[model samples]
Target: MGKVTGFMEYARLEEGYEPVPKRLKNWKEFVIGLSAEDSQKQAARCMDCGTPFCNNGCPVNNIIPDFNDLVYRQDWQQAIAVLHSTNNFPEFTGRVCPAPCEAACTLNVNDDAVGIKSIEHAIIDRAWLEGWVQPQPAAVKTGKKVAVVGSGPAGLAAAQQLARVGHAVTVFEKNSRIGGLLRYGIPDFKMEKSHIDRRIDQMKAEGVEFRINTLVGDLPKDGPAAKVTNDATTTITPAQLQAEFDAVLLTGGAESPRDLPVPGRELEGVHFAMEFLPQQNKVVAGDKLKDQLRAEGKHVVVIGGGDTGSDCVGTSNRHGAASVTQFELMPQPPEVENRPMTWPYWPVKLRTSSSHEEGCERQFAIATKSFNAGTGKDKGRIKSLTTVKLEWKGGKFTEVPGSEQEWKADLVLLAMGFVAPIASVLDAFGVDKDARGNAKASTDLSGGYATNVPKVFAAGDMRRGQSLVVWAIREGRQAARAVDEFLMGASDLPR
Candidate 1:
């Protein structure tokens, strides 16, 4: 340990955000990163616990203690190296990951946990600024071809790993841009697209090819819709991908949004979080979207308390909404988890996101009864919502008597989370799916990522269902190893 008693000496410090008034004016990253000295002190607080549960706590199994020591010792280069060993994109996780590692930290038994995420953010950003991040091309090409569908974190991680192992990896994205959800589904204010752009450049230099606007199923342009690519006539099909590539890995995200079937769901102002988020990201990317979904001067009601819902609140704040309110069916959780019982595991507790801190009226234990859209002038537009308190008994949720109420709501966003991967893409490939609609594949080493369909593999949200970005990266990296081993008899890539 760099400083044996550093944990006792230094308290945890986290990055602050710009003032709400100043930050709401624009869609940009508002987090003020910790200074170098402060970051070092934060790192020094990492106690030399015999068992570093933070490593296992992290989805990607990040080498937390090693990097902490490296940072404390002023070894910036080594810190970045250790950090990148497990995570392909620390910048993404550092900014958005809930930091379960902190929950599992031994020091967190009583006092504040070490500021691991903040230190991680500092290391990666510093590495980029110092030009320490570079392309690590394979020594020689293996003459093997690998097709990775979807360019999300999972796809990107797999592509990078395969490319490093001498495989000719090609990442195909259906979108106009390379990044799948990262470029679209996430708001720009949470994470700028520039990080994805720079990583794309690094991957390109490492011999990984990127195909954008390449819809693999029906061929967007030539079939029914207009051509997606500029002046491109031909479109690629799933069958074509099966025949052209040596092995195929499905790394697409779970895009099937959970819909609200209640009345007024089809209203003009009602929308899925995916639809609303991507448009903002596109606008941030310099592509103007006509009639962008704005919550300006309107009562914005976001359903669901997950990250997507928080994003809606943040975006609405930027849009200058008349009022923002979020609803969660579940009751509000305790501010702090009972760590003695829940140690080393993610516990049920309240999580206040940066967006939540910005502003929003949050309500829990309340369920929306129905949309109160009158047959008046506002026929197709939402006007108000009828909600009531809920009671759980005998495995059923019942509405409380005399608890019904109506609230003004001009715009509503459903951010309840994705149910499964879009069935169309899975059906197109004829890939077997689990009961949950995720791709059927065993994670065993013998079979690796091989699905029922030979040479077809699945990873990320496609196989595992909806999950965090870090888990997606882990799956992608592991899938890459499985693919490599299947192709070349054995693989040296890390799991």
Candidate 2:
């Protein structure tokens, strides 16, 4: 509401990116954030609608209008304060969130939505540059210990909240590093590791302890689950955590990738996206990986049309793949959404990520039938795959007759998305699981996030199945409040 006619006077300004050819050579963030002036103009586009749907549209229910107004008025400090009041890491969400808030913007019904994500990016980046982000240590110690398993957005959010409320918090990560999916799942080209590092430093200064390479529970010894990244040198059982900590929060994300049970799936060149992605991230972090999976000089086929699949395409291009092709089981969505019908809600529309723009041949309404192995010297490695076109009829996919085809491919990356959290970990804690295999937990205001087991709570993908990072952070913050109430009989922390 800073300027009533601002929306009519200003057009949305998008963030910029580096040239594709030049950015392909390095694994670093390429997005050129909106400048102060551009951000102000974009923020000025926020209409003074009677109701701001963007607040509820955001996973954390951020005060969107206030931040937009602050940014429009050039109040950088206040803008970040409003941003951090709801989000623990605007840097992460600002960089990677799909920006459902923008989709729900009042202006979006008839015009381009305000550039909320870009404004957030500018505010946080500026705040960091101005030394506005600092440690907020508690003045009094609660003397209660809390254990947070997994260092992803959810776990980090919960740990920071609990630590700020004067509780002793220790975060356990199975990987060698602190960030869970942020460090391994996301490519550096989208968001660099330095953001996670600085947050870890701030959390450390705020009296939170991080135990990297520590597994809270056992993982399956073999199978697809076993292939998940784990560099744990120490394993602590659920019983030990229950005895040692006042509360235990499970934020370990959904790590079980949905497998494609097709012929020749055992081919050496076929791998899960996680298997290939984490290795590249580790390499980028200066870790030497033995027999690293590379797409260089190979015909790469990435199965799945989600963000993970797009990421695969980008990484493959960075690896100098001869070609990259992405497949989608469903038909392609419309390029533009019908705002009249889907206003104030996330609409189904075609989304082409920066990775897709780099270079990728996308196939929709297709299904893979089998992987084929190579001959002689290339035996045991994937060579090609058979696919079939599908038609959507009567609410299900039916393969089209006489549409079978084989595509040449030297490597196949399965990026169909995660199914659920590692079952072994949930079982170890004696936590009940939903039909979908996610930890069974309710979000009820009374005893929300509480698992069946005593003193154990579950949040994020572990409880809700695979979802956006912003949702994970929301669950983490809410779970922290739930745990706080359980410990002190009440809580002042925001839900």
Candidate 3:
């Protein structure tokens, strides 16, 4: 779809980042994007593979080759239009998404894949700079009201699509701000909140109403606390929303984080990654935190080796921690994938994120056995941790004998991952739940996204489980189509 032989003529070039020392000093984005010429040349590498596996790899089914071709032809205006046709927030995905599409690119079989994400990032940023991005309000109002509970990616995408298609949409956010995780769970250095601010402005101009700091139903009482930057005092019942709106979409994310049940878990120096991350984000947003979970001059240990754990590492480094270490219970993956076996599919391999590159020691196949508080006035605060090595055999982990050791630890952050959506809101809406405790709904075309309640639907992490931002956007768009069809007897919206 791009220049026919461009892939053979040119090599790949990655995006740039600021120096570690300079970027660590402040909570701001540091990744420098591709130049116009660089992006155009990269786009020209698209092979026009007859069956684009990239579409399948991407949850949103982005028309990758067509957009690449458009960019190569210097039609920047139409490039963004084609992009927006499938995804609501390219800017968000461009910055934060792990590009599965690139992995599935045709060139990836024997060469570097087309820089699809970089192309996308360049397209949206250029569109924004050129004033090509604007609100597309509905030509006619449908006289139907949709109450989207949660302001995360799914809710935002659904709200925008429904609003553009003429539905009166009201977004209810438990947090004081419009963006849910985008505004709170994510750190500012990774993605500045201003991106969300601009999108919210566009959504508002398109006739969407936002009710921030308004909690729907009640929060789950037990679990690794899913902390929020929003200081919400307002509460709205499921019954009130059911009565007021013609349709309701439950897009609240998976809020219940998995916990570590062990000795000294209640120690003052130990906290969940959410608790630590949200506080830093709030502080970066200029909110004052009272004795917040600072890692300065203290040994910090993060329990988990995923993005959340990486985020903890970056944040702690920024706080000037004495030392930082990350532990993963599972064995480490190979540095590179075997392309022949895993072509066009996500492969299990070691990934080093930008945060990992900043500074931190990583340990694999290790498990925390216990914790201890030294004898002092701060006896309830953790001062040391006991851990053990593990061996994986037959899909089970067995502790290695004589491998137990103890180390000094002043702070600990639990980042194992999320297990379920907060049970309270789903229970309040009377929506059935899957075995894994997420809101249950089908994805069939006829009745997809409909919850047990007649007019209530569910999507995103709240309905599925913990996943990438791109998946959440896909669910939101699909659920919007389902809601539109249910309200209008049929929908012209994309599925």
> Cα RMSDs of all predictions?
2.8, 0.6, 1.1
> TM-score of model 1 relative to the true fold?
0.96
Q: What does candidate 1's lDDT look like per residue over 45-77, in tens digits?
A: 999989999989998899999999998888999
Candidate 2's C-alpha lDDT?
A: 0.96
lDDT of 3 by residue, 1-495 (tens): 658899988899899999999999999999999998999899989997799999999999999999999999999999999999999999999999999999999899999999999999999999999999999999999999999999999999999999999999999998768887888778899999999999999999999999988989887555554353447789999999999999999998887888898998888888888889988888888888798889999999999999899999999999999999999999999999888899899888999988888899999999999988978796888999999999987879999999998878999999999998888789998999999999999999998999989899999999999998999999999999999999999998998
| lDDT of each residue in 46-163, candidate 2, tens digit only | 9889799999899999999999999989999999999999999999999999999999999999999999999999999999999999999999999999999999999999999999
TM-score of each: 0.96, 0.99, 0.98
Q: Residue 261's C-alpha lDDT in candidate 2?
A: 95
- Stretches of candidate 1 exceeding 4 Å from the true structure: 218-234, 374-376
- Order candidates by TM-score, high to low: 2, 3, 1
lDDT score, candidate 2, position 164:
99
Best-first order by lDDT: 2, 3, 1
Cα displacement (angstroms), candidate 1, residue 459, comes to: 0.4
lDDT of each: 0.87, 0.96, 0.92
